[model samples]
Target: MALAAFGQLNMEEPPPILGSRSVDCFEKLEQIGEGTYGQVYMAKDKKTGEIVALKKIRMDNEREGFPITAIREIKILKKLHHQNVIHLKEIVTSPGRDTDDQGKPDNNQYKGGIYMVFDYMDHDLTGLSARPNLRFPVPQIKCYMKQLLTGLHYCHANQVLHRDIKGSNLLIDNEGNLKLGDFGLARGFSHDHDVNLTNRVITLWYRPPELLLGATKYGPAIDMWSVGCIFAELLNGGKPILPGKTDPEQLTKIYELCGSPDENNWPGVSKMPWYNQLKSPRPLKRRVREICRLFDRHALDLLDKMLALDPSKRISAKDALDAEYFWTDPLPCDPKSLPKYESSHEFQTKKRRQEMRQNEEAAKKQKLQHPQQQQHGVGQTHAASHWPAGPNHPMHNAPPPQLSHAGGPSGHHYYQNPHGGTPGPNRYHPNGNQSGGYNNQSRGGYSSSGSYPSRGRGAPYGVGPPNYSQGGGQYGRGQNPIAGGARNQQYGWQ
Candidate 1:
């Protein structure tokens, strides 16, 4: 009895890992996509045979231990619970390979890889929409948009900002369920509007005017702007409403389509630090309805509210869900009724397109090198002019443009209309200032100070001042804390 009591008194408990598993438990089938911070693999659990996506955390360039973005994503996802949001099942680690001279395990526990496991999604919005000859019906578009807004509403209510909202970041399952993914750029903001976040976020095409104008003190309104872009893209038959290559170009496109922001419209627009530097000549008039003439009245109304020039005036996700467009005829179809599609992802589809381009270049070179042999063939029809059916034909050498990255520069290059002409009416003039207003040819980068983009794909907006506060706040989940408004002073917003 004495021994039992002593054992109970002195027995040590195991470290509380919370049932953390190892990556060995899951079998990686193939790589499906890549995010800003890691490579995503389509994996399956060995025991349960449940398919999942394993996002391998990138560590090569991290001289300072694990990435903070990954940590924030894991923490924010833990607090969020919604069907529209991507479910982060659990974190799994690889077995360490480091060993001592005696072949025993070493002290280093961080040598192995780390992976975040999630439910495997069949296709991202970009890939699914890119499939040629696949036009989403009105009902289907409504269903997807509703799901997106519902998920976004949940995120906003939780105070989490998904700064990067684009087609590629939205994952869709075969059952027509859409979920918000890629929380690497996400941050938890305060309700008091006391935090200042980097304005250089979201892809160039979907970015809002407020962000482009260098407004560091922002809120959920920024995300609504992106939703507005997606809404237009869906209604426009999968064409991006505003596709811009550079920062000035992006803002110009926004001005042309949504109309230039002025004191009359956006009030306090001239107060933004970069406003004087970046503001372009006011357009003749707002063209939201004129540009989207084919769209029904309800869609135009909702889009105008969402893409409001004033961030304060922008529509909230909750209000967007209650818009008239969803209540009208041809209501959203049941998600179960949506057709199942084969697995497709942006990474795989983009790679295939790259290979096709290379093949085309090779064919062009062969034709140039052997001009005589090509013209001398008696029965050789005009293969270049027509798409031949036979496998041997050069026209049939590659896939049929299955992957369409539509956000490619619209007013310019290769993104011509199906009718073989530049985009009608929407095409922007390089020098759009006919009225003789602020016109500056020397444009800058994504930062408020106007610098060049240096982080490449890793930091699409380019690195800026640290986002979090030094002294941990209420929302600090260990390393990542809620951003403070102290940085706003630098940009003159405070």
Candidate 2:
């Protein structure tokens, strides 16, 4: 990936170039903040006469081409249209002057580009948490937690996993509506695909225990673990629940607070890659009261379920929405009803624009001063063979249909009997058993051509598509089932 090249060699290419002229419908306002990969600016939509946020990514430092994370973030945002998630209006790729002499084209111009257009928002939850006088009321904190969970639930249901779930990634609009942004660490899962080979994703601070132990075949449970940490942070007034300088230290802190995992609590805990090397000497036996004396009992109870060491036992997004903590008092306000401000309290909207222009100029100067690093010819060869497929790959399609609208009092009610008490035809018919036109295309050892009939019942969870069907052939026993069509018989079981 281009990112890999940037890290491996010292390159002197000017940082990615920002477009001189804003897009047709938007007028560049001001620079708000700078990030590892790019700078953010406030822009006004000329057509709608509304303000929006535009992030410009620098590609000059990149060795191969565009960063994979950026592409992944864009893909996830384009398909996800939710109230609690940030909206991506458009992506602009424009040419500008090149800073590095060696990388300059015959015309002495840079080939790098920028991305423009996004919904404008105020500060992130991280900044809000740092304010000393802004003691958020219980009702208000609950409101934020509920919105965060709701957004997470939406992402999980869509089969999109957000590896990073921190305060900085959560943005609050002027109306105080919290939306999930920064999909740089997000990944999409599909039933038909095998697990990827990489285990390097997510920020170290919010990583789940399973990930810390090096388990690669994880699911939405990984994300749930981070959400649990964020919940604890909220209750503690922005203090991290498990703050460690390194992976081992973080695990030790978690064990100290929640108690060590035993066979009964987590069946496969001992077999993880790093399990033996960093085993905790003390087992966790403290009650919730000892951890945080000041936390509300009800909120603490929810946090316990979310932070469960056993991924299987962790509370799901659907179940979390039904928790009593959310229903007790100070109900969440509608996203559209939150307060909106014309300008940020820290920086006047106009001044921010001027700074952004200045930053761009400074970036160009820095690029010109640095000596250009030689590019390996190998990058061009690798780029063609490993060109990233856009968002439409079969393996990257929408998540399996969720059991939406089951006849239950709450969304969590379906967990009581996840299978709905009816087993369907044996689509995987054992060895040599030709039950459902078994002799078709081969996947692993099973026929991929056979059609599994889908049985449509009332929505099982009131979130995803209705009814579970046996679609993707079994990758292994006890493996998570993938979604199939409505006509396939795999629908009846679970």
Among all candidates shown, the one with the greatest lDDT: 1
Per-model CA lDDT versus the true structure? 0.63, 0.55
RMSD of each: 16.1, 24.0
- Model 2's lDDT to the true fold? 0.55
TM-score of each: 0.72, 0.61
List ranges where model 2 is wrong by over 4 Å. Answer: 1-27, 46-49, 98-109, 191-194, 286-289, 333-494
lDDT, candidate 2, 162-273, per-residue tens: 7767665677765557778777667777544378534555555567788878787777777788788777776665555665646677778778877787787799899988
Tell how far residue 486 is off in model 2, in angstroms.
24
Clashes (N, CA, C under 3 Å) per candidate: 0, 31
Clashing pairs in 1: none
Top candidate (TM-score): 1
- Cα lDDT tens digits, model 1, 154-206, are 78766788987777778887656788887777887766787777886776677
